[model samples]
Target: MIKPTEKPTVTLVGMDGDMLGTLRCVEKALSLAGADSEYLLKYQNEIIKDDLYKDYNRLLDVTRKYVNVRRLSREKDEEEREKARQQRRGERAGEDYKESGFES
Candidate 1:
C-alpha cells in the first residue's frame, strides 16, 4: 500500500494544434508570462501598454477562477463518493450493522 500527504496532480498535458501544453501552477505560469514581457523589450517600437504581462495577468485571473471552481467541484465529488462508500459499507452515524452469514 502506498500513502501520500497530498493528492496526485496532473502535471503534463498533450500538445496539439496551437497548444504547446501549459503549466498547472498559476504562479509559475505568471512567471513565464513575465518572461515573455521581458523578451518583448528587445522590440524598440513596443509600447509599455502592449506588454504581454498585462494580458497574461488578465488571462490568469480567469484561469485562477476556473481552477478554484474545478478544485471545489472535485472536492465535492470526492466527498459524495466517500459518503456513498460509507453507506454501502453499512457505516453510518450512530448505527450498527452485521453481515449475513452465508458461507458456501
Candidate 2:
C-alpha cells in the first residue's frame, strides 16, 4: 500500500482489468477510506479532489523546502561577497598608510 505521502498517480481500472484513464485516484481512495476530507478538499477541487489535494500539499511542502534551501544559498553568497569587500578595503587602507610614510 502506497502511503498518502507517496503522491502516487491514480489510474482507473477498466472492466476488463486494464488500466483506464488516470484521475488522481489515490487521493480519492484515501478520502473514501476516511482520510482528511476537508484538508484534501481545500487542497484540490477536481474529481478525486481529495487525492489531488494530498498531492498538492506534498508538492507545496517540497517547494517550501527548496525555497528554504535557496534562501540559505543566497545568505552564504552575501556573506562571501561581504568578506571579499572587507578584504579589498583592508588592502586599500594598508596601501594608503604605507604611502603616508608610516613605519612598517
**Residues 2-102 of candidate 2: C-alpha lDDT, one tens digit per residue:** 22443333323331211122223434655554547664554344424334334544443432321221122455666767898999999999999999998
Steric clash pairs (candidate 1): none
Return the lDDT, model 1, position 21.
Answer: 28
Compute each candidate's TM-score over C-alphas.
0.21, 0.31
lDDT of 2 at 58: 47
lDDT of 1 at 59: 40
Clashes of each: 0, 1
Put down candidate 1 lDDT per residue, 2-93, tens digits, no spaces: 22222223222221111112223532333343433343232212323444244544443444432331222455666767888988776543
Whole-model lDDT for model 2 versus the true structure? 0.44
Name the best candidate (by lDDT): 2
At residue 97, candidate 2 shows an lDDT of 91
> What TM-score does candidate 2 reach?
0.31
Candidate 2 deviation (Cα RMSD): 18.2
